[model samples]
Target chain A: MPENEFEKKLKKMMDDFHLPPSTSVWENVSRRLHEKRRRKIPFFFLLAAGLITAGYFTYHVSEKYKQNSTAAISYTGKNADKAGNYLLKDSAKLSTQKPGIKKEEKASVSNTLPGTQQKIFKNELNNKLITVKNSTALKDNSSELENDNAGNNKQHLNGQIINENNNAIVSNNETLFKNSITIKQPVTPADAENTLLKDEVQDNNLALKKDSISGLANQPGNSLKKSTTKTPVTINKTSNWQWGVTGLYAKSNLIENLTNLNIPSAQYSNDPLTSGNYDTAFKTTHAFSPSAAYAFGTVVKKKIFKNGYLSSGLNFIHLSVKADIGKTVDSVIVIPSPAYTYFVRGYAQPGFVKTNTSKYNFIELPVLFQQNFFHSKKTSLSYNAGFSVRQLISSSSLIYNQINNIYFSKEELLRKTQFQVAAGLSFEMNTGKNNSFFIGPQFTYSLSNLIKNPGNSSFHFINYGLQAGFLLHKK
Target chain B: MDYKNLVRNCLKGNAEAQKYLYNHFAASMFGVCYRYTKSVTDAEDVLQEGFIKVFNNLHRYRHEGELQAWMRRIMVNTALTYLKQNKHYSSELSYEEINLHPVSSENPVITLQAKELADLIRQLPTGCQTIFNLHAVEGYTHVEIGEMLGIHEGTSRSQYARARSIMVGWIEKRNENIKQRRYAGK
Candidate 1:
């Protein structure tokens, strides 16, 4: 068999051959392209709807957390304050009465007469015995009292009555002194009897005077002590358990600076296939506009020390960023390849105006330690430092290539999770009882790349925000 | 429309220009696909798929070569991909089978139309038909066909020879039938 005749004939036959295709082929291709375009429209609409729904849910949850926390704090504060004030007043009154009793006992012992000291001593000793017995009975009755107001003041009054018994001994010494001077003429039994009768009457008068003094002390002690004790309890309980809801708004920006790989200008221009002057410098300009961000969460703060607290909570955050990237290529080359014999092709050097808008949604867990530097009844200043672990729930990036007139969308390009460090300073003004309105300036710096691709231009997001919240302190 | 204008409009997503481009090139490209596939319906499927790829990748055409040739390359590549995916051609070949010759027969060359010749070529085994079409009609060397089909160059040569012998036998048998019909008419 010879190749010459067959090859020549077949070449001639195929060179002029043409076979018509069915019309339905173009219809199917057109329909598929239309379907592709239609597919993208609903995806964008669904994304927008999801974002709105999440935002609505976050708002209601934040509001509900704030109301519940505020009510719980106020209730706890009032109850604990009432209990603390009652204890403080009782302790103060007992402390003040102990000294008064000692002074009266010393006075009674020193003022006794020497001549009738023996007989006067017997009456004074009997009066001291009776006073001690009466004081013990009063103490027992006072301890048995159960009324909130009455029980608190009765213990103080009983202490005062015991002091008055010491005063009774002093009154007996005075009666003896007067009797000895007036009845100096005789040492008779009748004189002694008259003195005893007069002493008994004096003792009765002293008991009535002591009772009036105790009544006077009880009235003022209850009124004056109640007012003084309440102020300190409120101030001391400021660092107790607290909860709050912060609505956050932030201005976010990316730190993007890409290192360009420089190739020699002469190398590109001297190639025979290249037809243009080449620029050695390869520079990319990244224009970043301020991106809006929002976050809200319920935070629980437990007082761990006098001025320090530990806080943790679940926070939902939405961060959006827009970046315009511009790059110019120096030269374009055409390499004629025998493998792809139809076209002379090389690397495409189309200058692109790539505008990228990225939105990220995350549920974050923030663990923070806060310390109050300055605290007062009306205002407080505090600073907190913390780290947060954020799980990415959803993300989307829309990239527009102006040179190609193409729009591409990518979802979940970022990593599934990210970490960040945050620090803030808060200025809180006491707005009502156990409640404060706080405004804080907070800063967050990302610790890891938010995206999965390492070759993608590195983006470090620095977020600065004003955090406004209602803080409720527990007792 | 001119080639450059047609391509530029297609790049701009002009539906009319795309349909014009498809109408202009579908017949010639289908000729290329028809030679590679087993039937006209299979060829039509390949033609539709190839044009879709061409439209999608029009931006990469560069316009440095003839538009027909670029489209021809895409169609060829698409046909090869279809054959590989469908396993119409066996990838494995035995050395003993390549050496085996067709039994010789006494037949004369018969003048046949191109369509009849293509039908005779399609009658050969799938591997031989592909090698023969690539080497003879498409003007590719044994080395290029081997690279495309992932076989050795010697194997492509052997397969092309066998396809040529089979087609010659079919043409001889057709010519003998024509002689008998003439004798019966007498």
Candidate 2:
């Protein structure tokens, strides 16, 4: 269709037109960009906090259950101690009786004493028997008892009781002397007899408790059955260290700096048709398309606190870029002796670019902080963030030189080592007692440029992909 | 300010440079978006989206042609995408075959102000308004418009003609009203 004058006038009027957008549009754009930047901060702290919390909570709950069980067993020990004290008191009274009555009581108590069993029987031979006899003997002679009470016996009473009950288990080896019994002298025959009597009483009390438990188990009621079963307890503890193998597939791209791209004008033949087509091609910016990148690695994680973990891994990462390079014509040119004119050899045409891919491989070591955000009996969700150190292992890529109008191979253009910031979220499902499988999205961005000195051109690789792996819990 | 320096500074994340670039092109780009969209709010939305793409893809622009032209292309594409994505515009954008009629080719002088002219274009049916703005104002050919809108070339031509005929009628009516008032004053 031919252009009408009215359409031309309208086009000119529209071309010169202008209307200002509202100020809030800029505000919204700025705010979104700012938010995107803020979101990019490493999530290392959150991951670490979560893992540490998880580890600590697991440890604390187990310890608490252990304490409750210990308290229950100690209840029986207390009852046995009370019975031993009663026997000691009776021996004190018997000291005043006739020698015959004392002998009969001693023989009867000796007969009732149970056979020596476990080493724990020594716990029943506490110093209370000796203390009681000494105190009772002293009461008969008031002057001597008062002096003993004011001296070492008072220290023994205050310190030894605490050591025997609680401190002995918790105190370190260095504090052994303080927590151990410090009996200064040997026991007399009378004192020995009293100790034997206390042991018999403790044995009898233990036997009575065992009989009561059996009696309760024999009952038909649910409550009695529960009481008998509750006496024995078991605990399952969580592991503080884990090791896993992970793999990821993601879209990868390099962000290039465009300002430094110095594209020279296309040099073409004098043919008008050929120059016109080539001019349009030369004016267009070269475009590189990204391909799917992959990474595989093994990670080692250590619980740093109740809910956080510190993790590090060695990964093999592959990144690639594909560029469409057009068909090329190779020709030998001869120059005359008088005029020195250089011609660009091996120059590929602009518009006919087919698929030419460049590949990059790196050995990367990632240091991350992982945290468990949610957990259940069989599943958990955690997030991780940190940094990575990558060493380029190999590079095979085609470099386009616009000034010379040629293609060349150059691996030296890129830096050998690169640093990247990374973050991820993982959902883990425990498949067995000591193993779990986890999968999540992982994002990694290079902090340093790939090109050594790109002048105004910079290239940085960005990767985001799903990572799936299995971990073995170390108990 | 030099545009090369401005673009470089913007790429380096300079806030002042970015604001300066946006302020320099916001009005003209908003005008392009306004022509493509139905209302000011929608035009602003398209303008916002277009500027974001411009900033993000600024590296691809190798200083070829005018920077305003580059930005304007992005704005137009963004507006087209917005229209297709929006349910209201997409439904109105359906291109059905219309009866062919011979309309007068006589060119009447458009006496309306630019703002009035834009408002008059907006008053046309959504299909006619879009086709008129694209064909008459943006200068897209029927074949190109057909490919862009996923319609046949003949359908695009018919739509463009219908829009042009209607726009001519509205402009003629406005001019006649102005002439009547002037004659009464005389």
Candidate 3:
């Protein structure tokens, strides 16, 4: 072909030239379309989780405040006279004892008493009944009091009944008056057992005294009427904030459609003398293989409502994908230039047995709301849902070109940031106080395209995997 | 599907219609991408991005011209944008730097496949390739190309001329190699 003819032919051939993109391109586009649709849907799950958590916390705190206020009111009213009588008896017992008891010893004695007795003791001490005593017998008596309480019916005694029990009154007076100065002695387990035995004996004596007091209260001469008011015991429940670290593993596959594109082809004849005509058409197809992804991160969670929590965390993720482009051309013809004379043998056919491997690293931030549906002392089951933002830290790809007989590697031009939605269920086992081990299955779907070029295949990743971690909590 | 119905369905966000449109024109559009980019992968990137723009902005089509022509224009603009953003092309090329020597053959001719010709074109400088593609293949005038590329019209013509001269020299050398190979074989 001459220069002018060649130019004209080239123009005509260029119009007919068609080269189909790799199949992964459509997959990329489809993935991006799905992401756009997902992003378009309002974050209703997150909003609902937030509203429910807020309502629960508000209701719970209000109920607790109401209970506390009611308890305060009852303590100050209706029980006032009974508390006054107990305070008078405590003052009388303290005055009868030695007058030199140390304040530190008094504090230790107060600390050792049971909850109800400690309140009565605090009231008596507040009424100016303090005495400084450096006596070993007083220490012994306080230890005896502790043992008596420890060995008793495992129930709290009422404040009003402390003065009414005759044997308890006698023990209190003896502990106060006895000033025997025993020298320092080594404490032994046998001595401790003996002390416990003595405590049991005192408890028996107290029971008898309680019987006597009941008899007296029934008598018409008794001025103090038996108090009928019963104080309810309240158990305090404290919620804690927890933090954890997790390692995760996932497997993902590319979702896309397969399509072929046409390329220029040449038909060869058997005769060496005749040149071949470029009438044939060639085509190629592309596909992706499954890939594995890994991630690790730390999370901090705060208890919001009863059995509910809000958590946020940062994660580092590594993702990889492999793609293959199949057979494209049948052969190439080399023609020497000057005379347009060339011997053509089948050579340099564009067979695209090529693989492209792409890897990405990202920093992800996630906010989630978790609710515990079932719980026990040792175990609980919960569900969580949230959204996350992922920023690409780095991305790279290695391309194997069979025709070129070389490996090409380069940094990929991917989107700097992406978004995802995540939801999961977890089973937590309380291993110790304020500590737990949790294992769960989680699912994450991309809400944005991974590549920068909108014209390129839109790549999105869907990951599902098991996440396990240990949580430490502070109340 | 016919182009009119396909366009209507695509406007309604019909996936099948979109796929049909893509399948129908992906190859020819890819050829245009290949002419502008450095590698097949880069070309595929341009093709995908171009189609996305086409799909997203389909409602803007007023049916004023051929659909292929409209899409081709988008692909060209997209390729140019990719080049500019990635800094793949230099800002300018001086006329003195270009090989302006003309080949001696009065009626020089060479036999080459379309793919081979495209490869030779890819070997040209980025500025020359953009100018040649816009002027010769895409049928854009120097004035239009200059407006699109933000350069002078004369600069576009000069770049195209330099590209043509380089290609002619390559063809002459290729022809000489063939003649020598034939003589050696004989």
Candidate 2 lDDT tens digits, B125-179: 7777777888888878888888887888888778877888888888898789999
Angstrom error of the Cα, residue A215, model 2: value is: 40
Per-residue error (Å), model 2, residue B34: 1.3
Estimate, for each residue in A1-475, the C-alpha lDDT of model 2 and write its tens digit.
Answer: 3377888788887888888887878986675555445433323343354456645754675465344323111112222433222222332233332132245434432232212111011112222212122211222332332232222222232134222221111111111111111112122223434444534344322211222223323423211222221232222223357898989899876655324432232233233234324544344444346678999989887665445777777899998876555555443322112212222223343434456677889888787888888866578899999888777889876554443443434464466677788999999998886798999999988877775433323567778889999999883
Task: For candidate 1, give the lDDT of residue B72.
Answer: 89
> How well is each residue in B76-186 modelled by candidate 3, as lDDT tens digits?
899988777543343433323343344333334757777888888888888888887777677787788879888877777778777777777887788899899999999
lDDT of 1 by residue, A161-192 (tens): 21221112211111112121110011112222
Residue-wise C-alpha lDDT for candidate 3, range A390-421, written one tens digit per residue: 77788775332222322233233355566778
Model 3 misplaced stretches (Cα beyond 4 Å): A1-475, B1-5, B11-13, B37-42, B56-66, B81-126, B141-154, B166-186
Docking quality tier of model 1: incorrect
TM-score comparison, 2 vs 3, better candidate: 2
Number of the top candidate by TM-score? 2
Cα RMSD of all models vs. native, in order, equals 26.4, 23.9, 17.3
True-structure RMSD for candidate 2: 23.9
Minimum summed lDDT over a 10-residue window in model 3 chain B is located at B87-96
